[model samples]
Target: MKVALTGAEGFLGWHTRVLLRALGWPDPVLIGRADLADAAVLADRLRGVDRVLHLAGVNRGEPAEVAAGNVAVAEALARGLRRCAQPPKTLVYANTVQAGNGTAYGDSKAAAAAILAGAAAGCHLVDHRLPHLYGEHGRPFYNSVTATFCRVLADGGEPELRDDRELRLVHVTDAAAALLDAPPAGPWDAAMPALRIGVHALADRLAGFAATYRGGDLPPLTDRHDVRLFNTYRSHLFPAGYPIPLVRRADHRGELVEAVRSHGAGQAFCSATRPGVTRGEHFHLAKVERFVVLRGRAEIRLRRVGGRGLVRFPVDGAEPVVVDMPTMWAHDITNTGDGDLLTLFWTNDLFDPARPDTYPEPVAAA
Candidate 1:
């Protein structure tokens, strides 16, 4: 079914788009700032869509601006809905759990919900009251403290917590799933805390992840929350912390190199590719994958799902290095040498054909 999405470039919006792509859902009609400002444009965009995910709003501005901005978008959308030739079947508003809490943002969110409800008279209105969301590529200092900490730590800087408080954090992907009505996403209450931790504890936990990962080793991802946190941390180090050189010890015997070392569960496999053969052209939603060249020269190329430029890395088996793939980025490795190319692949989870978590996308595409 066709879907229309506002705030399509925001952190949560991007994750929703990624989830939709992973699920093989139809492309969404992106409702940008221009569309939101013009009711006629928004109406045209949402006219025949099966679902409308309203995710745009201002949350980090002056109290008055924040409240007014949030309500304005809702009013624009309401106007658009009324103008639609065929209103969307469902309208999901990404409201926060703090709705109606008397704060400017909270009261504004509550007002937005009411406005949408009145406009979407016949449509199924889902006011998804989400909690604190943290995920990959979230804006530092703007999205959440998790993002800020991750960015500071990843950039070799320390993070200082001003006021420690409890946070009910949820992964953006999970939030995205709930917004999309995707399967395995059970009924999530407005304030369901997937993982609850104090500010200090969260900072320490993220610090531990960074320290372990800095040494080219995966930390103990004992559960889903840990994995999600680790992935979020790793997201900040992409295209910079790659090609992790392995410690090659040479003594009396042949040189030895540690290819895969993880404090978590994973699967490893090797592949031999003929010269000029490309091995992968896929992206993972949450899988942490690593590629190590063992016997030949190759070029590893990666491109973000919705990006245009390509990131190329030339690798050689003679000097082994680990290149971990970031989530949602399409990647591929090709044998550039004349002889057979040997490569080792490692993932954070065992292969499950039923749920491979892999999606096909060419890295060469712009």
Candidate 2:
């Protein structure tokens, strides 16, 4: 469907754009803050748009400015939509959970929602009262505590949390998905999937992740939320803190080193492959697997299930490197050297005979 989105440069808007593209939706016409200030520009942009996602607002500014800015943006959008030849079939407003509170931001959001509902005469309006949203690349010290914490920890600084307020955080991706998945609405209230935790607890969890990950160890990914949080935390450390060198202990008897460490890891196994032999040719839906070559040389190949290109990584036992397999990606390893290959494999979950997620698929399509 043709979509027009405001706040396209913001954190949540960026994720929504990515999700829409991943879902094969048409590229949205982005309406920036300046465009919202201009009725003609906004109206022109909304001309043939099928859906309108209104996500622009001022969260940080003078109290009066914040309140007026939000309401004005809503009013501008309403006016633009009314001027359109065909109003969008759906108008989704990104409201906050604080809309009912007595605070200035809350009052403004509530007012904006009301304005949109009134102006969206024939169109479906869905108001999502989202909670504290967090994800990769969120602006630090702006609104998200997760982003600030990640920034401080990644910069080798301590995050001082004076107020241990309870926060219900929803990943930006999940919020975007919820917006796309919501059905046509006539003034409905909804919330995205969130993880509720105290500020102190959240800080402690992130601190633990930083310590473990910096030490070249994989932190415990007990649940999907933890995994998402870990990924978000790591995204803050991009370009640096990568290619973590593993600690290797060597002796006259032989060298021994820990390949992977995870509090939630369930199973570990080792495999031996003869020269010119290949292993794996399959993919998993949820399992997290790591392949580490212990002896001989191998080439690990991976390709997304529906993708055409394959990614190949040559690994050797002389210098161990762990290659993690992503979900929905068909992967395999082949013995590339003249000698036999010895590989160690670790997975987050134990192999279940009854409900195996492994799907046979060639990494290289014929």
Best prediction by TM-score: 1
How many residue pairs of model 1 clash at the backbone?
Answer: 0
Residue 122 miss distance in model 2 (angstroms): 1.3
Q: TM-score for candidate 1, please give it.
A: 0.96
Per-prediction TM-score to the true structure, in the order listed:
0.96, 0.73
Tens digits of per-residue lDDT for model 1, 1-366? 798998999999998898887777888999987887888888888877999999998899899999999999999989989888779999999999999999999999999999999985678899899999998889998999999999999999888978988999998988988888887522222233489899999999999999988879889888777878888998899888887899998998889889988987899999999999998898987788999999999999999888889999999999999999998899999999999999999999888777778899889986
lDDT of 2 by residue, 199-226 (tens): 9999999999899877657788887668
Q: What are the lDDT figures for the candidates, one per model? A: 0.88, 0.79
* Residue 123 alpha-carbon offset, candidate 1, angstroms: 1.5
